[model samples]
Target: MNCFRIDESGYTGFDLLNADQRFQGASAIAISDEDADRLIKQHFPKLQAPELKYRALSRREANHPRLIGLMRDLLSDFRCVTYVCDKRFMLTLMFVDYAVEPFYYERGFDFYAGGQNYAMASMLHMAGPTLLGKPQFEALMAAFQRSMKEKSEEALRDLVAAARATNWMELPEVLGPLAKYAAPECLEAISTPDLTTDVALIVLQSLITRMEVMSEGRYRVAHDQSKNLQTYTEFLQRFIDHDANVEFRATEITSLKFPLKLTAVEQVDSKDSPAVQLADVMIGAAIEAANNLAGLRSGGLDAEQVLSLYADDQFIHMVPSIDFEEQKRFRQGSQSGELIDYLAGNVFGPKKR
Candidate 1:
């Protein structure tokens, strides 16, 4: 563990790594008094009392292979590699409040590269200095760490609000712009699907997630001329396909005097023409069917029967715009086996023996 302390000179020690070895330099890294205190709590999780105090303060500009490595670990745990890899971007993000430099523009390339990072950083910028006040930032960012974390829904709602109010205000523009390039038949195919309000809402929500991620991804590539933005454009296209067309079969619980089977087409986008309307109706119909089944399973529509409402959908949609392989690789590397299994639950549900 590399320990950094604040010296009388207002600087700490930094070990910057060069190609073959290492050289010591004055600490260019800055640490606030509050940051030092939090650092202690992080390392000594069990230390509860004044017994563990910031007796001294030090700053190490080291990539603190250990500390930075742990940060990478926690970030991976939260799927944050997209943020850390681009230190320059984060630095700009940190300074966003001090100034809105030309660096803040969201180029098309940034839409694909480190998209999540860009979303987060943009979120922080939009959410403002309140976000800089440690507790607030941690609370807000904690949502990105786990799929099922507490308050994540609330955090996401906040994100939705922020996204809608800011750069994402023109999401509908994507539909119009892309419509220009795609084949008329393909565009028609994309546009003609029918969807209901409920399904449309879900589709909109999913697109928001995708776009936020894309923003970060594009930003990463945009910042680096060496990086190509086309990959992100391809990513967007694939994500759209996977999210709208990827399909699997599931036995939906239904409730008619005579049971009926519903064919659910996965990956329906709401902003697309009629298809979104159709998907919404199907979802609604499915819910109605599930409710009927539950009511029958439990005598006389007891409240407890509603517990089944929590059951996972057998076949849900993935965005075709994303690269499923890339997403899968991301999930496999960052999450635990159980978390991965939980995600797959939507695919397999309770398999019939």
Candidate 2:
């Protein structure tokens, strides 16, 4: 059976809309146990404390040319899969929809229209430092504060009512002039399910899909041990087991017919697992590439250039191609014209009809 190790970058708890949080990425590496040990002994024999992490690699000092070269070399030895989340757009969609319930409910709070307003305000505030700038963020905050002070309950109800009336297709109109200020990429990142859940599913789905395509439909997965990740894995396993016949989507191609059967799902310490460490490095690099593409970072390899080296190269798999241009057009009300109707049809009605 093929063995894979998984690790993640930029996990900021359930507060996906935090101003400092930009991206959430998960990386999986498929490598033989023998090769994993060999590579670790050869390359990271002297691994130290506060060992390599994505955030450190994102910095110019930590991502030195030599280290980059070493990472490039390591890429050749394993099959890699990565999923990056656009938190801003994900949170925005959640705030306006029923998806926000899970987030608040998980924290012992009941979700309501008032909660939606609070979430929207938080999202806007978080976007201020990066997308809107300090001044605009303050202005938006002032507007929100005024609304709260004047007619807090009524305003929240109105906002919720408006959101209920609108759909994904009508986001631009619903947002009005404020739509322009919202990044096209952000708006486009919205998906049917929440972003974190989508990423988790995609990562596992892609790993299993690739395994089936390369080998048989047999594999075991090992992920870096963490309480939060453990919960996610258990939830995902339940999801998979509950619907054995459900087709796996979210691959580069179309759906996979074969049901994913894991020989075992294990969590291991990164300190002991070379495969997990490699996954960490690869995910960090993927995050840096994404940040470069999003204009959040610079003075290093361009994202497109780095991605091209791995594109369809059989080594690295980039999941769910992000088309900024297409997303921009969608934001401008050009493409996916039926989005509103589609959403309206899918979303629950007042009477659950």
Candidate 3:
């Protein structure tokens, strides 16, 4: 079985609405164990820095010929799959009205009129059952209603303060039910950009897809150690077991399956694993490319150009194509366009040639 190493960059925990977090992505690098050992021994010693990271290389050796040469060599040596999400566009497209508004309407509250009160109501309604339990959620709703009637933000603030005083896990329960209510498509859309679950799904899918075509669908996957490793592994196992389907917008629906066999999934330290370090470098490059696309940076190697140098389709696959026109519309502040129409035109349409 072939072996692949995975790593991520540009994760901002789970704050989907944070404007500062413009990008989120992950990368998987496929190589045989012998090739991995050989490549690291051959290339790592030539680097001036002890570690292989995109940010450090960009900052300290942006103009270094050796660094550029090393990057080129790494790209040529491994098969990489990367997925990047534009967090700002994703949030605006998925959450604001379609999710938040309908959630409030279901509870007989006018989301627009209540402003912050409405926001608090939506949060409590979504998170209540899961995090606060049904009883506490209902009580919080009662408090919020009282505040809304009296035109005060105090009750909502108090609840939020209490939630903050507890664990961070207690705070983001809003994501789950909100995603469920949004249903089949909305859940996928919302989760697609998530730092944890959705990102892992796509990365694994990409790896499986590439392996099916290139390596007879057989591989052992290794990843850099992460707090979410178990969760990610469970998700992958479930997808394979149940034949889960992944829909890209509406353009394509694919069964998340491997044609051959997956031998193992394991985690390794990047400090000790050259394969994981290479995955890190690949993700770093992807992050830089995403930043350039978002206008956060300028004048560097475009990610597409680097992928082209490898001369293989499986070398790099960017989830949600950077060329997607709806992304352009969202970036241009035209989010008021009908969601269905947008999906039909951009996502559900036949793949562009």
Which predicted model would earn the best TM-score? Answer: 2
TM-score of each: 0.16, 0.59, 0.54
In candidate 3, what are the lDDT values of residues 172-251, reduced to their tens digit?
53433333232233222222221222244444555565554555555777877777555456655544443323222211
Every candidate's lDDT: 0.25, 0.49, 0.49
Per-residue CA lDDT of model 2 for 1-353, tens digit only, reads: 77778777767655444566577767666776567667655654665644455455445554454446546666565566666666554444433332233333335543332223234434443443455445543343333223323434454344333333333233332243223333222222222222232334434444555555655556777887886577547734643444235342322243444245565678887777767777787777777787777778775555665565464633333322244344333234221112222222332111110
Of 1 and 2, which scores higher on lDDT? 2
Ranking by TM-score: 2, 3, 1
Error of 1 at 92 (Å): 11
lDDT, candidate 3, equals 0.49
Clashing pairs in 2: none
Candidate 1 stretches greater than 4 Å from native: 1-54, 57-148, 151-155, 165-353
Query: Ten residues in a row with the worst lDDT in model 1?
Result: 6-15
Of the two candidates 1 and 2, the one with more favorable TM-score, higher being better, is 2
lDDT of 3 at 100: 43
